[model samples]
Target: MTDIASFRLLQPLSRRALLGSAAAAGALIVLHPFAARAQANQAHLRIMETTDIHVNVMPYDYYADKPNDTMGLARTASIIGAIRAEAGNSMLIDNGDLLQGNPMGDYMAYEKGMKEGDLHPVMKAMNLLGYDAGTLGNHEFNYGLDFMFNVMQGANYPVVCANLTRGQLASDPKNDDLFFKPFIIIEKTIRDGTGAESPVKVGFIGFVPPPIMVWDAKNLEGKAMTRDIVEAARAWIPAMKEAGADIVIALSHSGIDAAAHTDRMENASLHLAGVDGIDAIFTGHQHLVFPGPKTWDGMAGVDPVRGTLMGKPAVMGGFWGSHMGLIDLLLEKDGKSWKIADFTTEARPIYHRNEDRKIVADVASDTRVEDSVKAEHEATLAYVRTPVGKTSAPLYSYFALVADDPSVQIVSNAQTWYIREMLRETEYRDYPILSAAAPFKAGGRGGADYYTDVAAGAIAIKNVADLYLYPNTVQAVLVTGAEVKDWLEMSAGMFNQVEPGASDAALLNADFPSYNYDVIDGVTYRIDLSQPAMFDKEGQRVSDGEGRIIDLMFDGKPIDPEQRFVVATNNYRAGGGGKFPGIAGDKVIFAAPDTNRDVIVRYIIDQGTINPSADGNWSFAPLKDTSVVFSSGPKGRQYVGDIKGVAIEPAGDGADGFALYRVKL
Candidate 1:
């Protein structure tokens, strides 16, 4: 979280006031020791959290196939050690997303294979660090239930997730308590002001996003069921409190939102805070840090930033080993009870800031962790390099978002092709198909050199992962014509609303994450930038809530609300990432048991040559006497010549150092 003034002390009260009111000054100084003692003896309960780890045990990014300094649990090892040394009492916990992300994870899953007693490398590293507990992230199910269970067996600590349960039974007879436990209680000694150790019981309850079973339906089918996060918390918290636990902490794998109540879209950290007896909440999945102390709406005395629930303390650590969350709570002895007197919360980054605004990694790799995964790393290098298939023509997504480009068309065609065969015996086999794919290699965050450059030749497995980095399996959600329109309106949230005839309007939304925008190519439509977005970044509807999609037509006709169509997308969106109407996971007609990256690879293999050209199936809304400007790097110069019906000219360099282009449409 950003630094706030509340944590820092102000210059000793105005000298004039001190001098004019000597009596009040003396009284303030007399009371200062109590406040100072409270701050000094504050039972600092340091909570170190890692989220969305995606199995990067080493300091590397396997998708980019490079040693990246920006992400890795190994790099953050020093910070974790230092933070633990500074705190009075510390607990290390991982908020899920640990199972799959890199080639290393894939290598372990497919090539090495998890044996019954084999220890997973990632789990071994986490064990060495002494993790107290962990929850399941959506990616944990990528390798299916059996694999997940086998991997968890390697963890030295309890794998806790209250929301997930086995099918048809309270326990799995084969390996009871192997995959997950509802909660865990740890007894620790806390030091009083006189340095006397007092016994304290800390309770941790873990919860994963309930939507995971829906998102990873192919893997979770008939194996497990997931309950909503808040509902699960409500059921579990009371029992946890009754179990004689003084402090209760939530390892929430769900996200925190500005919303006050629990909804299908909002994970409801606010609602979780309102629940009685919840002491502190450790949140994840959203990958954001709470900016400051925020009281739960309609709840008394709960401050999320101060790491307090119902006057207790809470924190949401930033993701990818970037930051470790710290929450310190001070308790006062009152007769036979220890009640919290004060608290503080901080999200500390692992990297240090340089004068040039660059983050410097300070930790050296833990040799034990590195040695454990050395064989796996070498195997992944070879596995990713293995040629999967040949692409007869260049497969580029330069125009994927603006036009019906072959890159997206290839993926769309592949999804439609895969679903048709998979659902031959299903009831929805006759449904019309539409595919939603986004420009994963889009310009932003990914520097100028980050675009896809797969030449017309043998494509390797690494290239496939590059094209689709996220571990999102293919899901086809059935929707009516009107819902389809709303879905498009939601996708339009990617662009900034440009005023009519405004030449310098920004093309993309700075705050709206680019990865979440899915460009549906099967239907013809136009984005009207003149209208505001239908929804904001938090999924809240735009103030006006009027449709932003203009002239939306399906099959050369105006959309028919009664007509139905199946739009193929990744599991994330179908599970609720977009919050688009009528497109939840329940609407899924078919979920391919393979990742979208795998499908793209198979598609490229089946089709020898991809021309990488747009079919002109979609275009912008009419721009009469209007000119718009956008920025792209020198690499994008090659494809700007392909935009139809637009007069394009080189404008100037953008503030970000990319070449700016002015287009008259």
Candidate 2:
């Protein structure tokens, strides 16, 4: 009943260079004009989506300072250009997260401040690509309204989002004071399967995660507000249909996770699809792809092979311009209004890791776009390269998980320093303070080289970028001692179950991301691997398990279960980016506008030379005659002697250029 598949060959197109510079005042390159109706009743409408780009426009990784094939819009431009050529009618649209994420974005905001008439590099690229419409994502507000509003002013295409509003009344589209237009109507000609052509009104309404109010509370507390995604969609979708929209597409800046933890859940793309009058949905925010075996195989309601959500076609282009999402519709003229007869969705990635672990370039970067932003890109490179401070010892995360690591320790120190200063002048000064940090560069899907290994001196902006990996603002969450134990239990879920006296048992859970493995710096605890994890990855309790986190203590005594503690964390975690219990929007007591990376930079500058030490806060409970096998970057071999609390040695090489090590529990 659905053609939500690309059974046909996904034509890999060479990215032809656009001759003109991408930075010029480029006119919108309209693809088949609506007034120029095609010659058939059954017309084709191909919708192209670039989701979660986060402002990476060029084919480069700023953190790595290398030619990256998997990221950047310039590379996807080739795929989009090829797809446009193959189709008779098509429109390019963005699925949000366009204005933030990259260090280049921070460079532009912090070093190269925006003026009244400045166009952001990513906005220019989207305009040059002839994007018909776009939406806003959660990261958009990270830089605040003035910066975002200034950037949005330069966009030639219409930007629409139904959820974000200035005030309570969202009834009248014109007078509602909505951040962007609620929906835009585009009249386009479609070539039906019957070889007939007609003009059909395709409407696009945008929705952002409702948690933005909490995530960007500093920027959005008074002036702006957000309604729940589903509620907002239901309210506007009916109006879109009544407004004579022939077919409607939901540009959801959300993800496909079916679990709704709250009434205003973060990832509600699936729920948004169930709303009436929405023909298709483009989802993002998780930075993951759909219609692939890895993410979609055997999921409920999702037809992975066909790329359908509840029988409706959906696609999520990978983040950082890694992939281009395409949805082709066969619209048959049902009298006056056109109805979708058939559709297929596919997410085409720019590069793939072959069996040999080599990253092959699937498409070349578009020079035209790169040329336009060439000056800005170079400026950003210099911006990141400028030295900030020095480190006494080399900072690396190769042994971060198995033992205390300076890489994670430095972040915790910076957070503790910043949070303590803030707490000193407040009523919360009486409560004890703790800092939580996770090693972001633990070398997973980004490859073995995707780890933090800063040499013992001269920390620059790029090094900070590698260390933190996000521009997340700092926040302090007030939690009871009981909740703190539960929180650590959730983070301890990163390890695999181990048996006593088991030889070479696997230690790490490959499915658990290193970023989710938060280590609390102020508390002494033991993670007993023999017991089951109390919480699953989604923060759902699998079982009321016993003592994974054992002997948790603070101030040289057992932690009082009833005592209150203020734990420092980033906005992403505090606002429920990770499904951790006891840390939600409501738990946040203090919100600092400074990003965690910036705090690290400031800490290093103030200290002159940072000495990162783990303070021996957390360790595993002893299990005699048992060893566990774990994998890390091959680079970990050099630091085996320095790791404490566990007897460790190199076992051998692991899959994908990693090293295997055995650690005595």
Cα lDDT of candidate 2 equals 0.80
For each candidate in turn, the TM-score is: 0.68, 0.72
Q: Model 2, 194-243: lDDT tens per residue?
A: 55566889999998888787667768878898877887777788888889
* Tens-digit per-residue lDDT, 529-561, candidate 1: 778888766666764756767777777888788
- Computed on alpha carbons, the lDDT of every model, listed in order, comes to 0.67, 0.80
Candidate 2: C-alpha RMSD to true structure equals 8.4
Off by over 4 Å in 2: 1-40, 169-175, 192-196, 260-262, 294-300, 388-403, 413-458, 465-519, 525-551, 560-613, 618-665
Model 1 vs truth, CA RMSD: 9.9
Clashes of 2: 14
TM-score of 2: 0.72
How high is the lDDT of residue 504 in model 1?
Answer: 61
Candidate 1, pairs of clashing residues: 307-313, 307-314, 308-312, 308-313, 308-314, 309-312
